[model samples]
Target: MVYRGPYRVRVEEKDRPVIEHPNDAIVRVTRAAICGSDLHLYHGMMPDTRVGMTFGHEFVGVVDEVGPSVRNVKRGDRVMVPFNVYCGSCFFCARGLFSNCHNVNPNATAVGGIYGYSHTCGGYDGGQSEYVRVPFADVGPSLIPEWMDDDDAVLLTDALATGYFGAQLGDIVEGDVVVVFGAGPVGLYAAKSAWLMGAGRVIVIDHLDYRLEKAASFAHAETYNFAEYDDIVVHMKKITDHLGADVAIDAVGAEADGNLLQHVTATKLKLQGGSPIALNWAIDSVRKGGTISVMGAYGPMFSAVKFGDAMNKGLTLRMNQCPVKRQWPRLFEHVRNGYLKPSDIVTHRIPLEHVAEAYHIFSAKLDGCIKPLIVPSAA
Candidate 1:
């Protein structure tokens, strides 16, 4: 699949990727996911998203070939690749901050390398094709547990891990009231994971009723349609006895709405980095000294966030590109024990040839689409 421009993607035959570095491996991609962050590129919201680039970060595949230096994995190994590309020995990687590794992205001043993201994120080709070249194969890709389902393995690459990390960042205490903004895949996962972290009450806010219903069913959380509430912040305060939630999560990131000016200036006009509405709302709706975990994807540009309110309220802001590989141990346990099933959120599965339609449906929110998986080698 290649990105042509905003709202455009095409599946075309391309040269098969080969192992370029001694630490690299060639993986035959079987399953890949269309992440919500990919929408930023699909909508032209992210900078330097060039045409002809493949856009996928969540994928699982079988190792087709391995470079001479690759040791942990060999040909024919089924592996789940993490979204972040790191050298494993970098300063950040040593501290388990693989997402911020220094040796991967040439533009490392901003962020580490991410597969299939824009040029700002290292310009690596993604795994939405039949084959993908995985660098630092030993540390970045994990062997899929034999009992794990393919659908679940693919999600672990990004969405599920990101959501789990978001909840972990909240530092939730027992009986804490947690509010998550956005009912997309990450939001739902955060809400569900919050329960595992001892959240007493989880509230998911979104405009779509279908997503809200999924939040309730999948996450076992209360739901609210932000459109129905005159003031969502006020509504949250009212429910929290005017003290506000113990933790507020900004899972909606840049494309959040409910603010006309912010929407126009940020999303529509591109004057600012993606809209800061959800982050600001999280700030206003969290209690003093509470925490805010940002799992949403934001562009490299500056966003007009409510730093004053956050400071005045003494909010502990925790955020980062989730270290996908780091979260696997606990997540694997959860999956094995049936604590969570990441694949439950999949609402559409389309062959690679129909990826363009899949993108359109997901972007337009048509047919109650929640998550869409891409089968690159489907017949």
Candidate 2:
């Protein structure tokens, strides 16, 4: 699949992406999913994406090709691709934070490089196609266990890693009450991560009844219908002895729809120009000395945050792009041991030719669309 332009997709023929560099590997994509981040590109939300650039960040595939320098993964091995491809020896990578790598993208406007994104990252295509070229294969790809199925491997790279990172950031511990906002794939995964981290109770919040139900079933987290709950905090407190949650993770990046911009006050207007409500809610919900971990995908920058609110509660705030290279291996072990099952977040699976249709349903949140797994035509 290739992007001709915004809102357009086609199954056109093209040369398969190959291992061009010494650290590269070519993978035959086995399963790929349309991610919420891809929606930003599909809806023209990301600038610099031009025609012919592939568009996908979540995928599980088999190693069909590997560069001579690659040592961790080999041909015929199953692997999951990480979103941010990082050079193993970068200063940031040495610190176990690949998101801030220095060499992955030398020409792009930013340094954090992702595949199928832009010329910044060697202009390499993405995995939406039958095959993809991976850079720094030893660091950017994680080998899936032989026993893991496609669905299980699907999450080893991205969402599941994000969930584990979110839980780690939240400092979730045994007997602590945790609440996750948004109940989307990331939210659901966050809830599951919290549970696996031994949170006493994990509550999921989302307006969609079906999604809330599925979160309960799949993640084993308690679900709350935001539409039906009069006061979400009150409801959560009832379950937690009115102490609020020990940790609250905001999976919804921005405000839902246009509700937060109703009055558009002048004083607040200047500062609230970008992503206002979601950050506020996450900051406000936690109890004294609590933690708030934000795992939602957001743009480059935003307005000033409400430090007063966070400071008053002695809350710890953690927000940054996930360093996937550092987190993927730990998450893979969790999957291999059956301690986490992120594949359960998937609610729909469709063929690659219907990529456009899948986007429509996924974007509109129609028909209980949770995480839709996309199988390419060749698969």
Q: Which candidate leads the pack in TM-score?
A: 1
Model 1 lDDT tens row, 1-379? 9998877789888899987999999999989999888887787666677889998999999999999999999999999999999989988899999999898888657589999998889999998889999999989999999999789999999999999999999999999999999999999999999999999999999999999999999999999999998999999999999999999988988882224654445446655457678899999999999999998987644556899989999999999999999999999999999999999999999888888998889888899999999986546
lDDT of each residue in 198-228, candidate 2, tens digit only: 8988888888888888888887888888678
- Model 2: worst 10 consecutive residues (lDDT sum): 265-274
Looking at model 2, residue 322 earns an lDDT score of 81
Clashes of 2: 0
RMSD of 1: 2.0
Q: Model 2 misses residue 57 by how many Å? A: 1.2
Clashing pairs in 1: none
Query: How well does candidate 1 match the true structure in TM-score terms?
Result: 0.96
- C-alpha TM-score for every candidate: 0.96, 0.87
Tell me the spans in candidate 1 whose CA falls farther than 4 Å from its real position: 256-271, 301-303
